[model samples]
Target: MSVYLFFEKKLPFREKKRKVVRWIQYVIEKEGKKSKRINIITTGDREIIKLNKKFLGRSYRTDVISFPMNGGIEIEGEIYISLDTVTENAIQWGVTTREEWRRVVIHGILHLIGYLDNNRDEQRIMKEKEDYYLERFPE
Candidate 1:
């Protein structure tokens, strides 16, 4: 099991990092995932925007991005998150920043699990799953 965590932008709250990691592990376990090989990277809006343009072909700032390495069921991938967007989205969505961050993490993990956000239906399903796992996350 390999978990790589990279940070580009300072997290708004330092105390919440451990909790976030635990919640991610919980999500993985809830989904019946056994291989704990996952990498999480946090970055600023600029980096995430560049990644969105380079990988997703969209030049916009997004909250999270997932890049799978093998396209297999072993769950080897990279997750890029923008703390700036997470804060802005938290305010826009009327939720706490931590909550929004959890949502983004859940969304990324779902992507690693083969969920696609390219289509309307797929996006809806992914959002539902995100919400479902988020609700089950430990506080």
Candidate 2:
């Protein structure tokens, strides 16, 4: 399995890129998959806002955005993240930068696994899954 990380800013300090890759691997393994390919693109707030509007039809900024390749056996997709949002939320949530970053990473992966957040019930379920993964893979 290959989990590639593409960053617009300097690489994260707290959680190495490889750690996130391993976390993805763990998720795939837990899902009974032998291998899968996932790519992550991290950018600034401006880029994320552009993507949010273009793809999601929302003008506001977002922390993480995911594009799934195909809903099939082998998982493949792209995860776009905003480091700016992560940093801001980290401060707002009283967590470290890496913690918030990891949370977003897990949130994106959960989306790839068919987690939806179009409504309040789905959003709560997705957040629960994110929180569970956060505890599963902690700093």
lDDT of 1 by residue, 25-63 (tens): 777667766434778888889999899999879988988
CA deviation > 4 Å runs, candidate 1: 15-18
TM-score of 2: 0.88
Instruction: List lDDT for all candidates, in order.
Output: 0.80, 0.82
Q: What is the C-alpha RMSD of each candidate to the true structure, in Å?
A: 2.0, 1.8
lDDT of 2 by residue, 1-139 (tens): 8889888876467456677788778876775553367888989899999999999899999899998886666777889999999999999999988888888988888777667899999999878877877887734
Clashing residue pairs, backbone N/CA/C < 3 A, model 1: none
- The local lDDT score (0 to 100) that residue 40 gets in candidate 1 is 82
Q: After superposition, how far is residue 131 of candidate 1 from its true place, in Å?
A: 1.4
**Model 1, clash count?**
0
TM-score of each model, in listed order: 0.85, 0.88
